[model samples]
Target: MLGIAAAVLFFIAFLINAADITTNDVFSSVNVMLIGLGLLALHVAGIGHGRRTGRR
Candidate 1:
Protein backbone atom coordinates (compact mmCIF):
# COMPACT_ATOMS: atom_id res chain seq x y z
CA MET A 1 0.00 0.00 0.00
CA LEU A 2 0.92 3.62 -0.42
CA GLY A 3 1.08 4.08 3.32
CA ILE A 4 3.71 1.35 3.53
CA ALA A 5 5.62 2.96 0.69
CA ALA A 6 5.43 6.32 2.42
CA ALA A 7 6.81 4.74 5.58
CA VAL A 8 9.72 3.28 3.62
CA LEU A 9 10.40 6.67 2.06
CA PHE A 10 10.38 8.31 5.46
CA PHE A 11 12.80 5.69 6.77
CA ILE A 12 15.06 6.18 3.77
CA ALA A 13 15.00 9.92 4.28
CA PHE A 14 15.78 9.52 7.94
CA LEU A 15 18.71 7.28 7.12
CA ILE A 16 19.99 9.67 4.49
CA ASN A 17 19.77 12.64 6.84
CA ALA A 18 21.17 10.74 9.78
CA ALA A 19 24.06 9.39 7.70
CA ASP A 20 24.89 12.88 6.44
CA ILE A 21 24.83 11.80 2.84
CA THR A 22 24.66 14.72 0.44
CA THR A 23 26.26 13.57 -2.76
CA ASN A 24 23.31 13.45 -5.16
CA ASP A 25 20.84 16.27 -5.73
CA VAL A 26 17.85 14.06 -6.52
CA PHE A 27 18.32 11.61 -3.65
CA SER A 28 18.75 14.37 -1.11
CA SER A 29 17.15 13.62 2.26
CA VAL A 30 14.96 16.67 2.16
CA ASN A 31 13.60 15.74 -1.24
CA VAL A 32 12.89 12.23 -0.11
CA MET A 33 11.20 13.57 2.98
CA LEU A 34 9.02 15.81 0.90
CA ILE A 35 8.09 12.91 -1.32
CA GLY A 36 7.23 10.93 1.76
CA LEU A 37 5.05 13.77 2.98
CA GLY A 38 3.24 13.84 -0.33
CA LEU A 39 2.61 10.12 -0.07
CA LEU A 40 1.41 10.52 3.49
CA ALA A 41 -0.98 13.23 2.39
CA LEU A 42 -2.31 11.00 -0.34
CA HIS A 43 -2.73 8.20 2.15
CA VAL A 44 -4.63 10.50 4.43
CA ALA A 45 -6.84 11.53 1.54
CA GLY A 46 -7.83 7.88 1.04
CA ILE A 47 -5.87 7.28 -2.13
CA GLY A 48 -4.28 4.02 -3.29
CA HIS A 49 -6.25 1.98 -0.76
CA GLY A 50 -7.37 -1.52 -1.57
CA ARG A 51 -11.10 -2.01 -2.00
CA ARG A 52 -12.73 -4.29 0.53
CA THR A 53 -15.19 -7.05 -0.32
CA GLY A 54 -18.51 -6.93 1.43
CA ARG A 55 -18.78 -10.64 2.18
CA ARG A 56 -17.24 -14.03 1.42
Candidate 2:
Protein backbone atom coordinates (compact mmCIF):
# COMPACT_ATOMS: atom_id res chain seq x y z
CA MET A 1 0.00 0.00 0.00
CA LEU A 2 2.75 2.43 0.87
CA GLY A 3 4.53 1.52 -2.33
CA ILE A 4 1.38 2.35 -4.21
CA ALA A 5 1.16 5.66 -2.42
CA ALA A 6 4.76 6.45 -3.24
CA ALA A 7 4.22 5.60 -6.88
CA VAL A 8 1.21 7.91 -7.00
CA LEU A 9 3.17 10.67 -5.34
CA PHE A 10 6.05 10.18 -7.73
CA PHE A 11 3.68 10.35 -10.67
CA ILE A 12 2.13 13.54 -9.31
CA ALA A 13 5.54 15.07 -8.83
CA PHE A 14 6.50 14.09 -12.36
CA LEU A 15 3.35 15.65 -13.72
CA ILE A 16 3.90 18.84 -11.76
CA ASN A 17 7.50 19.07 -12.88
CA ALA A 18 6.70 18.25 -16.47
CA ALA A 19 3.91 20.81 -16.56
CA ASP A 20 5.99 23.50 -14.83
CA ILE A 21 3.27 24.24 -12.32
CA THR A 22 3.57 27.18 -9.97
CA THR A 23 2.50 26.41 -6.42
CA ASN A 24 3.28 26.99 -2.80
CA ASP A 25 6.62 25.97 -1.35
CA VAL A 26 5.09 23.17 0.68
CA PHE A 27 3.46 21.35 -2.24
CA SER A 28 6.20 21.83 -4.78
CA SER A 29 7.34 18.99 -7.01
CA VAL A 30 10.52 18.53 -5.05
CA ASN A 31 8.64 18.32 -1.77
CA VAL A 32 6.23 15.82 -3.23
CA MET A 33 9.11 13.78 -4.52
CA LEU A 34 10.74 13.89 -1.10
CA ILE A 35 7.54 12.73 0.53
CA GLY A 36 7.38 9.92 -1.99
CA LEU A 37 10.92 8.95 -1.14
CA GLY A 38 10.10 8.96 2.54
CA LEU A 39 7.16 6.68 1.95
CA LEU A 40 9.28 4.37 -0.13
CA ALA A 41 11.83 4.22 2.65
CA LEU A 42 9.18 3.40 5.19
CA HIS A 43 7.80 0.73 2.94
CA VAL A 44 11.23 -0.75 2.57
CA ALA A 45 11.62 -0.69 6.33
CA GLY A 46 8.44 -2.75 6.69
CA ILE A 47 6.76 -0.25 8.93
CA GLY A 48 3.19 -0.36 7.69
CA HIS A 49 2.67 -3.96 6.65
CA GLY A 50 -0.27 -5.30 8.59
CA ARG A 51 -0.53 -8.97 9.38
CA ARG A 52 -3.35 -10.84 7.72
CA THR A 53 -5.96 -12.57 9.84
CA GLY A 54 -6.80 -15.99 8.60
CA ARG A 55 -10.49 -16.77 8.13
CA ARG A 56 -11.99 -19.37 10.37
Best lDDT goes to which candidate? 2
The TM-score values for the models, in the order shown, are 0.84, 0.86
Error of 2 at 16 (Å): 0.4
Cα lDDT tens digits, model 1, 5-54, are 99999999999989897758998998998999999999889888899656
RMSD of 1: 2.5
lDDT against true structure, model 1: 0.90
Per-residue CA lDDT of model 2 for 1-56, tens digit only, reads: 88999999999999999999998999999999999999999999987777755697
Q: In model 1, what is the error at residue 30, expressed in angstroms? A: 0.4
Model 2 earns a TM-score of 0.86
Off by over 4 Å in 1: 52-56
lDDT of 2 at 24: 99
